[model samples]
Target: MFFMFIYYFLFSWNLAGVFGVDSVKSVSVTEGESVRLNSDLTEIQRDDEMTWKFNNIMIAKLKDSKSRFYEDNAEGRFRDRLKLNDQTGSLIITNTSTTDSGEYTVIGTSTDSTLNIFRLTVYANLSVPVISRDCSSSSSSSNCSLLCSAVNVGDVTLSWYKGNSLLSSISESNISISLSLPLEVEYQDKNSYSCVINNPIRNQITHLNITQLCHMCPDCFHCGSTEAVIRLALSVLVGVAAVAVMVYDIRSRSFQQKREQTSPSNNE
Candidate 1:
């Protein structure tokens, strides 16, 4: 084992002249998109050899003007999605996902070895914000609380706004960040509030109209159960009184008819 380590150490030092790139570059892209990791080489020479690796694992190679990809070396998430250009030695990854984020290195060998490093970051798109109001305390409308929430977002920020003024903001770096922020404000007819979710590549928002939310309150119907019951009782009494008056009028007419018929016999 000691002899093997020494052999590898000597071999790496000898190849050091061919792989000279050590600088790191950062690139960010939204999920489900495409990104190109450029080699910064316009063309490859006839004697030049190029290799692309992910985290030091060789995934692709260019030899004698031909491009080759080793399926066993590619990560499962990147398999079948990696494309290499034979001329320039750049790599294109299609339909990238969060798991595809990592460091990629390209080594080119011709007269001298050149190395290019890329740190790729894949972020999921920001989700739309959902805004809701809590008005449980009926004492006053000025103490209502508004909540703004977003889920399954990445490299993004969530913020609250009242017209042109800012209320609160939160940011996260996780690939699937989820959070909520609350704003307490007085409800008014002309009050306007909004929630914003945004990243470098995309933006989402939701609006809250205070007047509309207030109209959803129970008291907004303008009447309670007691008032409805009183009105119903008055209608019933009016209906009963009309029925009694009609019965009395019918009885008086019947009695008058009978009295007239009996008096006619006296004339005979």
Candidate 2:
């Protein structure tokens, strides 16, 4: 019995591949947008019956030029969002969300059965990329540290760009989480920089303001670099030595004047 069932399944699949099965169509759409799955049929005859299924569960049907939608199916996930075209037996989904992403199949029956498949990917609206200074980084006076981030993102790419050229990039797939990318640039750099987050449907970008974010005071010193700290210490020591020398010279001049006055009095 098991062998017979396996043989029948394989035979059915092979026949489907040979005669009426079409290639799987790829469809991508952003959340809150509408998408249509084509049936590839020019017209539906009076005796034809077409059914739409999602994950192998029927959600819609077209028969005898009449259309029916099972909005309450799939745990009511398709409620008030499904539309069927009786003429071509196509299905349209309105106000789509990320949960709508899945495999959809359509089967038509009359004298011969026909099959059409679609792979749908519904992406959430991309959040704006946030650019901020990375204060925790060991940044030097000559270089600025920065981080670009996005939250609750999936199947997206985060990148840093210099003018129109790509600098660094990171990508994630199949998991929703926060994404962050780091960048470093010279404090006096005049070139334009930007951070971008993108999915298949849309992208978000944030431009970098080098002068504003990378500003450093003229007298500011950085302890992160040993060389810079050593230079600053040498400057402070030089200033203190010069002040001590001037004070010593003034005291010596005063002592000499007092000794000369005392000698003249003693001679008198």
Candidate 3:
């Protein structure tokens, strides 16, 4: 019984050594901002050695009241961006960008080891959504075609909403690219419509102006369509010709009346 207790104690101690007191944390920050990964330590001891790693590659270290930063690691992705706290052994990344997103691990050792893991996610600042008329999609005079667009967005959803109701939505992941969504509405409709672009962190919105966007003529004068331009030109020409014909007719009638009044039969 005494030998069995000794074996059990040894197994438990081995397990503890293998998996030390681990604390995991998740952090998110926008691009061009700073984020700090806490070490959960009140203070660094005299004999404690703390090391910070990015995806298992050493980036920083704190030992004996001195802090060292390896800013050239990870293919120079973290160049000049790492800061280590000598007192608490925390890691601070300044002016972060989307490329600086990944797993971070901090290991501290003295008599025993303690581990703190952090998953960092950095997001780019969102751009305002753009609203425009979709001229090609204007199928009829009563209906108007519209398009909402955003550029250089990643892991975002572009959606069209009508009076708090969802109409259509599209999403993209990982790749940064331009996105556009189309909506069709009636020219005389009086409902509120809006376009939204959102990510996990924040959202951008643009309200739709029905009167300004959905014209009664449906891109006749707004979109500068070739057919509309030709029609305008023909209308101008017709008005000019009608005015010329009217002037000629009025002059001819006046001359005929004067001749009739000056005739000998009229004088007798």
Ranking by TM-score: 3, 2, 1
After superposition, candidate 1 runs with Cα above 4 Å error? 1-22, 135-139, 174-177, 189-192, 218-268
Return the candidate ranking by lDDT, descending. 2, 3, 1
Cα lDDT over the full model 1: 0.76
Every candidate's lDDT: 0.76, 0.85, 0.84
Collision count for each candidate, in order: 2, 0, 0
> Which residues of candidate 2, in runs, are more than 4 Å off?
1-19, 174-176, 216-268
lDDT of 3 by residue, 140-224 (tens): 5467789999975588899999989999999988565689999988878999999999889889999999888765344256454
Range of the 10 consecutive residues with the lowest summed lDDT in candidate 1: 219-228
Task: For each candidate, give its TM-score against the true structure.
Answer: 0.67, 0.74, 0.79
Model 2 error, position 69 (Å):
1.2
Q: Can you write out model 2's per-residue Cα lDDT over 1-268, one digit (the tens) per residue? A: 9999999999988887655455677899999999999888899788899999998888998899888988788888999899988889999999999999999999886743546888999999989999877766768758888899987568899999999999999998756568999999988889999999999879999999987777543444541445667787999999999999999999999999889888967779
Candidate number of the best lDDT: 2
TM-score pick, better of 1 and 3? 3
Candidate 3 residue-pair clash tally: 0
